[model samples]
Target: MSRRTVLVTGATGTTGSRVLAGLRQRGVAVRPASRRGAPAFDWGDQDTWVDALVDIDTLYVVPPIEDSPTGVPRGMGDISGFCKYAVKQGVDRFVLLSARSGRAGNPEVVAVEDVVKALGVEWTILRPSAFHQNFAENFQLNSANPLRQSIVDGSLEAMDLGSPIDFIDAADIADVAVETLVGTGHHGQTYELSGPRAFPFAEAVRIIARTLDRPIQYTEFQPTAWFERLRATGVDETVIGLVEHVLHSHDSGVFAGEFDTVERLLQRPPRSFEAYVRETAALGVWDMNQAANKAMQHQR
Candidate 1:
């Protein structure tokens, strides 16, 4: 078989970046596509699609979640246009990065999945729960790193959804994505990827505190309170909306379920939250002294 050149959209993003790295590590030919990358690709600009699709036999798609000018979260309106275009250009296999909620018929995600399936190509959909890296990367609390505002001022609070969440590691998601993309027997499969167990947000805080040997408290906030808190910090409304959506979904028990798909597909147990925390701690990512020094510097 000729070398497979897989086009990975959203190549620079969290999960997409991991997927790209995994593909590269496996020695598969990959074309990383982003708005600014060479052979650039943009969801809103149809004209840029063909170049990104050129000579590609496999595709890894991460649909863009855009922010409306008014601050609401918006989905890729209709990916069918791009899906049909890719089919005509000769791409044969597809792996879509969708959310766990999408399996329950989230309209936007369903629209994209529908298009891929209707295109008559081999396809696999990965629906993963919230990523564990959200704490270290997006939320910023997992870091013993000083809160943008001093923790003394109560400026930083962990939003509790009043439920347990199955937080999967991004690396695990990438592993499954690679397998589905290059391996067989996954066609027409919609796997709900998650960590081995579900734990409440409070438990996550405790884990960080124990692993880092720091005092970290978990605070429960109503959706409205959390929204106002983020706004007060000058967080973008679009990002706040996305956060609210996920937290609210958690509150509603949307992410409370665990899945064995990760283990089943990878043929090994999914990495646990504790393992992630232990490894991260070893990296000194949660050093309290370092965070405090950074905070003090910012204050000065």
Candidate 2:
């Protein structure tokens, strides 16, 4: 196979970075299109978009972060106008990173999907579950609070930090995205990729605590307290609204199930949660919390 070239937007981000690596592992030529990467690209700015996309047959499009938390590509504006422009620019295959919003036919994503469909190109949609990186990278979970066992159930079956709720790695998403691009069997279809297990938040916290030998815990926030606390974190109002929205999602039972799309499709079990935390910690993410965080993060 003459290795196909791909332009990956958000190439430096958690999942996009991995996706880029995944492409390389498969012997495909990859042009990393991020402000930080070689052919650095930006989403909203038009100048960068065209050139990075030039000569590329496939794209892994992760819309720039919207003020909202759903990770919806267009409703907040960045991608709404870009989709039509992308197909019009002569790109053939598109794999957009979308969230579980508005189902498979969200007006915004569908609008872009419609554009690609009309352009007579092969397109795939990847709707991934919450990332395992969110734990080690979430910032909120790293507190060295006077630690409590109440937040985690050690006896409950648990996996590593990479486990829980089927959190798929970003690179895995990219690998699959690229596969759909070079191959034709997946055109016009959407996939929901998740980690291998359906775990409670408590189990996730417990495992992290045990692995690091830290006393961290998952404290169930009283609704009002939770909102007030997050609000105090200087998170913007829109983001605060999104957090509440997620809590509501959990309350409504929207996030309480497991699906097997990742391992089923890739034929490899996703990395376990504990392995995720341990590795990141060894690399110094969790293992290097500042002395200030020890007091400040736990103070609240």
Candidate 3:
């Protein structure tokens, strides 16, 4: 029997990296496809696609989002074309990392989902909620890099979204993705993965403050103010727009939905916000002094 090789796109990203580790730990043959990874792949560069698809029967795709020069959110461009090419390459299975809100609110995600489903292959879609890692990794709070600065000093802005969000951990998303990729009975299924419970951003900040033993404040921000703050920090305009869109959707009560999909798939309750905060705090993810020093040095 020939060994099955799986290609993981966005291989170094939050969820993709975790998926790669999980696959490797399970003794699965895996190929990481990224602009920097071997057999490099770029969503905008079609020439790099074919080489990365070689000898790969399964694919784990996380669509790349890049900023547009026009300051608009650029969705995955031409995913249908890529799906067609992948089908021609004999790829038999696909797992797409989509968002719970995107299924209804974002046309680009809907189009990508449609393309993957039409491929006539085993496909599983993961629609996950806001990731808990955003606070420590993507969002401008407690980031380790000097180039990024916190949008708010010592205070975090919470969207007045009118409801609580069930932010899932990236690791839990990875676990479920691994199972869907390598295990049985998950084909043609769409799983909405979320944390065990929903809570407002103020509550989340309180949990983080308690876990980290620090004084962190959460202030409710209107959508316009949030957009301006992100823009002032030199964030990509497209990303800022997307953030505003999601915040508006949340305010409209779109992202408050929760599910037991994670528990059912992994046979364990998904990691909670408190647990994520505790683990991250242990790793010094919320160290204000370190972050302040880095920012100060960068300014010099």
The runs of at least 3 residues in candidate 3 whose Cα sits more than 4 Å from the true structure, single-residue gaps closed, are 1-3, 68-75, 139-153, 226-245, 293-300
Residue 288, model 3: lDDT of 75
* lDDT, residue 198, model 2: 64
> In order, how many clashes per candidate?
0, 8, 0
lDDT of 2 by residue, 81-118 (tens): 55557667767778878764324244554555555456
Give candidate 1's whole-model lDDT: 0.76
TM-scores across all candidates?
0.82, 0.75, 0.85
Query: Across residues 224-276, which tens digit of lDDT does each residue of candidate 1 receive?
Result: 88678768978898676556555566667778778899888889999999999
Error of 1 at 117 (Å): 2.4
Top-TM-score structure, candidate number: 3
Sort all candidates by TM-score, best to worst: 3, 1, 2
Error of 3 at 168 (Å): 0.3
Q: Return whichever of 2 and 3 wins on lDDT.
A: 3
